[model samples]
Target: MAGIRFSQLIDNFITTIERYGSTVLQPEISSSRPANIRVITSEQVTDCKIFLWTITPGGGGPGVRPESERRIQMTNISGMPLWPGVRTLLGGWSQEFGVYAFWDARRHTKFSFRSPSLQVDANTLETAGTTGIATQFRPTKEGEEVVVAVAPGSLLWYVQNGLPLHNSQDDAAFVVDLAAASPEEERNFLDSAQSEIESARRYDLVETMRAFRDASFRPAVLQAYSYKCAVCNCDLKLVDAAHIVPITHPTSTDEVTNGIALCRLHHGAYDNALLGVKSDCQIVINPNMTNRLHEIGLDSGLEEFKSRLPDVIRVPASIEARPTPDRLRLGLKLRGWPEEQIA
Candidate 1:
């Protein structure tokens, strides 16, 4: 715990799972001084739950070398629902293992949350424990879920788990926006979101919203695409935003459904093909692009992306939010070219 930090390990594990998509072929658990290890996965959030556990001595497994290291992993078995008193007790013992119970909303049960025991300032703990705790259990469907992310540094059990967690409201926050919220109510929402973020040490709500914005764009593009790449149908690390339009001009093709996000090298190679995502959201590779193949590392990826393009097309924004086909066309034509305005 003192050597490397548990949160660091957990964060690495989370990242691995996110990238590999559960059920890693085999993880390389290092036996370095800190007994470091890493497992990679490419799963999205909804793919699978990674349940980690230490091989316990009682289970005829290696015991944690009290002075050196401990083991923890993602799991499905949830710890008891923690109350303020419960959090305090657990917090004291958490250093040994950064642990908390994660509610797997999908299963309607705790997915198992654990951390290497992040020590909180007494003042901060007092505020965090009681402040964010909803007096009553809001229905699962209601807006009541905590997305916790550890700070990457500042003495964590592991450095990797340090990413900031942003808990987005499930519509209630926006509902308040729609309703005639009095100044008091508006102030409360902002203050509450702000307080939880500061005490928990997270980026502001705007940051969280930005993440959604980026993801929406990616999702929108892929919705019209196949799960695999549209060019080569290679579903590996090749499906990503190709920006039928460049990202240089955020106004033009940054939104979801605007451009397909291609993976690895296809994006860079796309411009050569005169491959344009029509303002109509159609894939339009110039007739000439048919010539360049292996030179761009897209012999397989490009072909795969082509046929699968229409399938993965993302849900475009509302008519009003969508970029006009003309701009999209102009944007692609000038992409990577001298930034010239459309005539």
Candidate 2:
């Protein structure tokens, strides 16, 4: 038969669901690309089976290229569940039109999952297959139903049951505590995440997690330090949340105590081991930095930092939020500074 008319079909489908709930049925030609024959049993009553045909492109139909793009702006159809029958019938339609899917644990702590076709890696219906088969159905915050064809990047933190999905188990190899990942480490993570995406067929799950972490954690650090550079009190918006313990360390990376707000200058210095924090919270300029800056004739910036040495860093509002002395010592050690307490 001609391709399925998506608008009329979906409208009727939703109406049927609302008017009378749907029942699972077997497909006559089940293994086809788009299942040709299927059955729906509802209380409204119909003994004859429902036969669905291949979804075809309609002139001005919603799932067509232009119509689909515009429909993305409409929130009415967001978060619709794609049951087995619907998956067989409209899955190809959704893909042809760019409908995406994503799922998350009810809690924000665990990793999330997304439909594979959304990524740069793959896009064809043949590539995506079934949601479970395509993505291997990563564990959600338990009891959460799979949400199909959501707006691009929409996440489901809580399941339909209202329970928060939290995954406490950590995979040390893939999941690192990155307070603020170093440039190299960040690149490594991106590559690793990409590999995971391709291997597990999860398109943008890692990217989504990275975005969520930045949005929630960095602001907390900046606010904890009162939006000023913890080392030199630079108040510019250029201040950053620097991780005291390198993100590679096997500890919580996003905590305010593991972070210190620093301007771009100090952040770069700390990252490069040109600056170090003492056990007493004093900021020290690395001896190598002084020589290097003098050699490069870029010595003016040192006056501000050098004068601040022996003076303690600006502490956060809460004592518990202060960078731990052990982490500070770790920072000094990374800079090759003397371990003896500075006189």
Candidate 3:
């Protein structure tokens, strides 16, 4: 029985996301069998795991039966060590769905689906019934082989929606509908997702949601600003999607209206209160920094920043992507800038 190569699976995954206008960043293949791959989001934070298990015929259960009832057999792969960083079977929705573990029988470490009657002993881990985790993978028959073909839009939605622990088939269909939806309808869907994240009771879930939100937010801001720094217009590797109101603030949001594209230096400056953008889109440098310019070396950099001053910063052509006055005012307030200075 021949099996699919890990590389081919990755190529398929890449093709799926690219079709939906998303790029896979820093893909690291850690294993061949059971296909373990790690990816970084656009934010350059959070390691996402993409693990695939090939379901073979005639495995664990007595099945001279239907194709749908076939179980995925866990074969012992000796000397396989655990890979570092976060490992999730599908997307690490929750403990109830999947878990990170080391296979005692095979000495292999990876993410495994957790069934309701799952048993974990010192030597082996076994499941009593059909696990819900398999539904997300949604293995499909390709040629004569059964392989997991993850839905394209669902892959993107998983990163944006914090891997909601639910029926992935329905979620996949929902995302497909949204892809063809009107702008207002899409916005409403994103808003509803944000509301759910905000109302989440678990701290870990909130953090996961925020990380996922940033994954989408960074790219949106960069695109709105034409992938250039709004302050210095540096379009190189230095640009970063900076929050107008820092993420720690209670009222902070991941919306493009609450974000700005800036180079590393200006981003640091904006966060440190050394630079600011006003509601009228004017770029302002703090007087205190200007008062003692020579004291802080990097005079050339400071001059460059000053040269752009009294200047209206670049804004997104789309009204929705442009920074809102209320968010800018709140951000400035958080920076301790006086109202008179902003006015």
Q: Name the weakest run of 10 consecutive residues (lDDT summed) in model 2.
A: 156-165
| Highest-scoring model, TM-score | 3
Candidate 3: pairs in clash: none
The residue pairs found clashing in candidate 2 are 106-157, 106-165, 107-165, 179-253
- Model 2 root-mean-square deviation: 19.6
Model 2 clashes, total count: 4
Q: Residue 132's C-alpha lDDT in candidate 1?
A: 21
lDDT winner between 2 and 3, please give it. 3
Q: Rank the candidates by TM-score, best first.
A: 3, 2, 1
Candidate 3, residue 294: Cα displacement in angstroms equals 5.4
Task: Provide the global lDDT of candidate 1 against the true structure.
Answer: 0.37
Query: Candidate 2 residues 78-169, lDDT tens each?
Result: 22333342222223223353333323312222223332111111322222332211121234334423322321111111011111111212
lDDT of 1 by residue, 218-260 (tens): 5445544543455455566446655545545545435553565
Segments of candidate 3 deviating more than 4 angstroms: 1-5, 11-80, 83-201, 292-300, 308-310
Error of 1 at 5 (Å): 16
